[model samples]
Target: MKASKVLITGVSGFIGEALVFRLLVDKKFIPVAAARRATKFQGLCPVVSLDLNAPEAFPAFDDVSVVIHAAARVHVMNETASDALSEFRKVNVDGTLHLAKKAAESGVKRFIFISSIKVNGESTPPGKPFLADDVPAPMDPYGVSKREAEDALKQLGSETGMEVVIVRPPLVYGPGVKANFLSMLRWLSRGVPLPLGAIHNQRSLVALENLVDFIVTCINHPDAANETFLVSDGYDLSTTQLLRQLAAALGKKCRLLPIPQRCIIIVATLLKQKAVAQRICGSLQVDINKAHELLGWVPPVSIELAMRRTVDHYQDKQTK
Candidate 1:
């Protein structure tokens, strides 16, 4: 694949920001970033204001060879079920279809979609990790929306001649990360003893840098077209192990209380917080062997390094 112009949506987001930076550094390709709000990275690339939900809002795909769609409504608590489904369809599914159609119309070569592992399922069974070929059984509105978006992209690929690549990442974390991951980091920083120590369930996660690398590799990888991949850091850790690693990264001794899982669940059930308990104690893992065999891509950073970088960013933010 030759160096070509690329258009990336949600360039201000965590994965998007890292991706744009990587693209900017690549001398072969020129990057055009599209988002709803203006970004401080104006000097990095051509920034275009685009509202993907608007029917008339379509970027100039004429000169672009690849379109990387990374924008979506990602908050779990900020939206109701109805609102989430509606917004996800408008942005994740409909917006994706619109762009893919335009990409096909404009003679774009490839369309890469950044999807979530939740599309596979929220929690994996006892000993089975999610595989790329497994049937999608989304557990939440957000996952359903992503699965729909993937279906729409696949349909576009079949109807038109455009190549589509879908990459599903699990729990992406690194610098500039927000949401639940950040909350956990804050708790660790406060030296709070969390009951999560009792949960021995394993969860898979990806480093933002590794995810960016995968996205870039998908741009023109011959084997990635019309394929779905489940990506991770190639490792899984329990909640207790995760806190210990996070504490190590922060140069602090781990302070975790191993409260019995059954007791926690019982109390949470009585308090109507079972959902929260499930999120913390559930086991979720992804198998990325297909990605390795197809794209020959491996995570370049270790989990420890990634966590250290994440902690460093938080320290920098606190200092500022």
Candidate 2:
């Protein structure tokens, strides 16, 4: 029997790149990488340039067994675009629908979408975590676009009989990471004393390796079809704890002042950075019980190990 061919979009991204490596190492699947720009890819697999916005970018899906859609208009802190929502929908919604239609027409068996936890909501109510089945209350344009794409994907799957599996993950951390996670890691590396000590709010996070593992499992799992799942490190941590752990991983002592959370929020509001402040100080936890009961999947890497790998990679990059 031949290995099934899996199409991975956004193959150059941090999560996508990790997923690609996982698929390549598995003898049961062949990963076909697709991205908007030219990626080095290290000649690991067949690379194809795909423009999600272009109808002509459709793949020869006849031989493809699965489509793992990872490309999307992600969140931007300071978006200067004229219409942020429209820009996001163009690629995140319209482009996604176009790809799914082409894949369905070409007889692809499964479509696995890598969604974000932002689709669930930004922050959870005190002590209560966000569940997979909870109603969506998107707080930002990026989240709104993701919710739209998810709805469209499920509808398309229902009409076309394509197995659509949605996996919504929180902040993902690991080697070659970027964005806020990268900034956090860089800050920890400096061993600077900060004023985030009073933060005891729980926030969920997933390691890059663990997320890729879950995605690989969903490829052919019968139970994963048409189901949405949320994943994490099987552990939630407070902002202070996370910073301390990160400092430990970098072999530095974390210096955190026990500043009041209310004070921090007030400062953020004054600076017009309430959203940013909330991310650092608010609680956003996810319940992964659905994923556990349905897929029998667990994150392979622990939080401590994940942090070590992340810091090590950061150190290596700095040296190079």
Candidate 3:
């Protein structure tokens, strides 16, 4: 197959950086890496400056055939903005739709949007996981922005005949991971005894590699166009199971003390950290059956192996 001229936003982001390398190494995509700073992807791939907030500066899309959009105002905890939703909408909703509209007019063949499972809800009830077809009930500003973007993109696709593929992935963790995932790795690496042994909530996660693989699949698969997908590693693990598995992967002993879930939640609540509490005690899972049945896409990495790779990358970072 001929190499596609793929424009990848967020080239400096965690997932975006990983995608750039895969696109190069796989030799399937001639990635036009777009970022606010051209140096982000300098010397690695063809770099272009793209400020989503400034549509006037958006590079011409005449040669681009596919666009993998990964840029957005990601979720921030304890956000300091006075109007958080307004801040998010500026980049996530308005910025995304603007880019999609331009891509559609520029004759871009496909637009693959990276969305979040939080669009389904914060947590899932027992024995029921999030599906792509579920009505969105976003609980936070970030999720609301993504939900709105999806809707706008769907409408744009219908009106302009531009193929749109929406992918809602659960927590994505891997090498160079940051925020909560990185904090967890740091805590585990130092042998901190977490009081999360009693947590029985299952959370689905996708490996960075697995997610990029699926994106590539969507780039070419005919059935993937104009479809929404919920993707995971096809394995679910509770907090206890996750910590234990991560410990094993890091070649360390699991150190978790079984404190009651309510106790943990109460302490977190008193500390004004209900969101953190929910993450620890709540369940979040996504079903990838649609990706499997429709796109014939199975996660290329097993959870165990994925964890090992992630731990290895973390270890390498610590040593550096």
| Structure candidate 1, residue pairs in collision | none
Error of 3 at 291 (Å): 0.3
Q: Which digits, one per residue and each the tens of the lDDT, describe model 1 over residues 98-127?
A: 878888999999999999998999898756
Model 1 poorest ten-residue lDDT run = 75-84
The TM-score obtained by model 2 is 0.97
Root-mean-square deviation of candidate 2: 1.1
TM values, all candidates: 0.96, 0.97, 0.97
* Candidate number with greatest lDDT: 3
Cα deviation of 12, candidate 3, in Å: 0.3
CA deviation > 4 Å runs, candidate 2:
none
- Predicted structure 2: lDDT: 0.89
Error of 3 at 300 (Å): 0.6
Q: After best superposition, candidate 2 residue 7: deviation in angstroms?
A: 0.2
Clashing pairs in 2: none
lDDT of model 3, residue 115: 92
Candidate 2 per-residue lDDT over residues 19-126, each given as its tens digit: 888877786898888987777675778777789988785657759989999998889899989999999999999999999999999999999999999999999865
